[model samples]
Target: MHLFDKEKIYGDRLLAVDDRDRNVTYDQLDSFSGELYRKVGGKKLIFILCENTIESLSGYLGCLKTGIVPLMLDSHIHPSLLNGLIREYHPAFLYIPKTCIEKIEDSEVIWQFGGYCLCERNEKMPPALYCELSLLLTTSGSTGSPKLVRQSSWNIDANGKSIACYLEIDANERPITTLPMNYTYGLSVFNSHVLMGCTLLLTTYGVLEPDFWGFARKKRATSLAGVPYTYQILKRIGFMDMDLPDLKTMTQAGGKMPPRLHKEFALYAKRTNRKLIVMYGQTEATARMGYLPADKTLEKCGSMGIAIPGGRFWLENEQGNEIIEPDIPGELVYQGKNVTLGYACCKDDLIKQDEWKGVLHTGDIASRDSEGYYYITGRKKRFIKVSGSRVNLDEVERLLKEQYEGIDFACVGTDDNLTIFMDQLILDGGEEIIEYLYQVTGIGNRTAAVKCVDQIPKNESGKTLYKELETTADNRIQSK
Candidate 1:
């Protein structure tokens, strides 16, 4: 279902959104979006680079329902990269916070940040609405080029509903939005709340400080949504220390949480008698595919869990055959409505597999337990999970290659550490480079601990030798 119908369906019921301002009701939200739609001329592409705020949400749904495509770029993106994405998307309109408008130039439709601009639309201008609504979100790939994954209303809506059903989010629930609105996981939280008429407390500032928990408790939050690193912060500040009476559940997704932390949270839930749901998903599916039930969290610890409603998942062996046993390792493949239409496909070659049906061939490795719970073993390629954030080894190499004199580099991930071995010549400012990394990756944590490797082993064709690099990583871990 389209997002407009949801606002209509909820009517005057509570849709409290705690954004930049205090709180907004459904009527205010609906009216605000309607006004923005009118100002947007009902459709086209609008680039959002505003801080996470109520205006952002209003603008996002406003563009969606009114037949416009909203191209989302990270608000904190580099100036050069931001300009590149803008040129690539060539959006007809641009809507950011009123404060950011002065920074950008050349747009046929530029809506003021806070105020609604509802000018009449010319029939000759591009149609505001399209039969298929989609978004172009950047996915950091190994190729160094930020690929845009396209998703639709129907795909995302079903995904949201599946999450709501699995997590049991309702009008009484309030989900804290800590991740960027541009990401699928963050967008899913927004969509699920909007679809169920639930509450969402949006904030880019994470719970790094102890006071953040107090704020969440003060809001009487029913739920908290966080990635792996977020759980790490909570664990650090005493996951068991805080007593949240209103907190019925919490969700973990985006990347895998370490088994050790997962168990601690499980015990905390056991003591508090609350639910901790470990989930898994990607941007291509509009966020969320598998989720471990709250009751079965500890029992199914370390697994990304089973597929959500209206979704089918299975694992295949290395030979590309389905693993018949309960303990066999296989690549996770998901078939669901929430799957994206296709990748840009060359631009058109972007979308891959399942031409006739809805299925996503995920590259990660996993195994199923006797109870049907799926546990992530590791990745097939050299991709790393640093602090619950997916970091492509090739992406890091690409960035380093652009700076270094040569184009040779390799990267790898350990159980909890990320290692980047350059040609040794490109290895300066060790700690300063780590600090700079925080700016590049907007993940809500001191996500990765970096180290230097003397040489990056590769074969004749220049393929990274995984066996040798893994040995080096194991030696480093032992040395530590």
Candidate 2:
């Protein structure tokens, strides 16, 4: 099934709402989308550069109906980066919000939807669904440079189905989203709700502000989703104080949450009658693969739960052999329809989809307990073996989060050394945390010593990129 297939199934139902502006009904969505489908019915690619508002969403939904592959570019991106992406993706046509029109002068047609100019209406967009890709997203290039990942129409449908099935979403469920438009986490909320015919409320403009809670309560949201960074901020600001009723489930993903924070939040959610769903996923896997059950909260402190419906997982050794033993660290392999259509190493090439052997190598290291519960030991990149004893920096990061106050951190290792990534103001806290790390693991006995720094590099999903951090240090010292 395709993105449009969901709309066709739930057509004339409430597809979306824009309470901040005027309410948009299903008939309105159908009329506007049909009009858009009529207009851009032949472009191989259509670039949309709009903000996280109603217009952007309408254009996004319209892309589904048109079967014109939507290539999304963040409105806040640098002009040079935007130009680079445009040249690389080479979208035959472009749509920009009126606020961003003047930034592009060389495009073939800069049709301004949502208050922008009508640059071109010439290209014919195709209407085939099965073979088409729904949206093209890139890894947050903050890791160095962005690489494009193509998600087929089926991949999105499967992701929505998996999320809804695991979350136990029903027609009465309402999900609130504060995630940005260009990110997978945000897209999942929109896609899943659309598929389930559930109402999705949007009030992320000034998140963490006092007003957001008022809106949350007013919306009577049964579900909320956030990243580790988002949850960190919420905990800092006191999420428990809001005490939302009618909240059925809240999900955490993007990066691992600190164990202490995980426990506290789980407890807090219990008190507030919310189920904190700790989930594991990447953009490549369509959004999620594993999610912990609410009842299993705190019982399996660091586990990321088991695979969702329509998916299977297993741990594989270095030689790519699946291991059946419990608690054996190996690469996480996912097999399912939700896996991505491969990723491009660069902006110019499209990497075709293929399961290595059969399952996708998730680049994460994990092990299952005797009870069949899975736990992430660390990222494959975060492991530093010093004299045969493998050191998982995620363990260090978790310890730091517990020991240090008001600081979330990353731990990276290279050349037989480990460095802590904390904010500039938290250097002293990092030093204290490192002292505790040495006490816990006796790192001094290992091949290398621990170091602390003002900042540790991370990707858009808040994932620590140890490889880039190591290279960044190398380049800085070499240039000096």
Candidate 3:
């Protein structure tokens, strides 16, 4: 059940095709990964700066095959964040692009794969990587947070199999890259496709990019997966009208898509004889937990649907008691092999055992219907999905203060936009602050808004009353 084991049975078949249409066969991937394995495989822990390229995939497969725990990161990560991660984890090796190696000094280049360089860390201490630890990913979207989701090889395999089963992915499917390789949703696509011997089309172009659609058309891509934000872009680009004849399956996750958009796409799928699957997941669950079946899309338009095959979802009240009655909002609880070991905030936390114990207390407020379909009401966590990436409002506020001193601001959001409510609005500084917010959170400016306020609504305990801010956001959106 290894992700790449199908290569043995499908050696000559196309496993991946890059934007250039340079197809890589299963045998080619095997041989390339073998070379990478021999070069950088022995490291106890390696930091892989990843892009959606053939070499990045090879390095990832190589690390997994050789038992090297790889902390996959975005290739274009901020230098300060990368430095913070390096200082915290002290990985034994750094697999980075050749152009980016200059930022990392005191390292010897041991191997090169195309444009990527694998360098051994200098003065490296042997990482205390747990026996079960296979991957470390930031729970927050690529915000350079030290907090990470700890996953075992079993977690990846189980989740991939479940996703493949529900999505009906097979060797004939061709899934094009729509998100960053560092993102869990994107990685899940890679894992599921690889496990099923499917041809994965790799591209760096984004969903809004014309080149991306052109490549999809050329490759005759059969399936596509995206976060809610991606669907927003699809709607903006008039995706339903596009002539993608080979597209049979479309998946949405990461955050709740607007009910209107959900119905829009579902109707489009129905008209075109396609499937639009709305899924629910988090990084802590190794990418997926629930998915709404195509047949139930219109009937249960906004529901997250039932748990995926091999997974179970229930609800628990604030007192940790089970909630079984329909329409009762409670925290969504999931139990599955895909549930991660635990979170890691620093290096010492890596050796922590499976603290989650196969049960993930997903900090989401949801309700189940009579038919067992779950619908998200809100989030318990102080995170917002901006363009498919989780942006922690608290973290954003902290960074905003650091970026601009004495500016009291509170970050709040509706599903589609992040509004920065500032107490002291600096003249002509709105766009600048918005730009900084985008830089820090990876949320685009289109979804970021700034509003001047007399005061930030706060409770007596000095806590910014986010509920008040949310009301303001709702009013603002309604006015627009």
Evaluated with TM-score, which candidate comes out highest?
2
How many clashing pairs per prediction, in order? 12, 10, 0
Best-to-worst ranking by lDDT: 3, 2, 1
Candidate 3 lDDT over 56-173, as tens digits, reads 8877877776678999898877788888888888888889999888678568998887889989877456558888899888865556779999999999999999999999988899
Q: What is the lDDT of residue 348 in candidate 1?
A: 29
Looking at model 1, residue 267 earns an lDDT score of 85
List TM-score per model, in order: 0.75, 0.87, 0.81
- Model 3 local distance difference test score: 0.82
lDDT of the candidates, in the order given: 0.66, 0.69, 0.82
lDDT of 1 by residue, 360-379 (tens): 88888788988788887656
lDDT (Cα, 0-100) at 135 in candidate 1: 66
lDDT of 2 by residue, 1-480 (tens): 444554555666665544463445555677877767666655356767756666777777777666667767676667777767655545566677776766665655434454544345243432232244667777763322458667877788889888888888877887776777777887888887777777667664555687667767877878878887778778778777767878778889887777777898899878877789999888888788899999898798778999988889999999989999998989998898888777664434442544332257888888899988888877787778655678887877777677765765666666466665554443243345545766888765234333334556665455666666544432121000
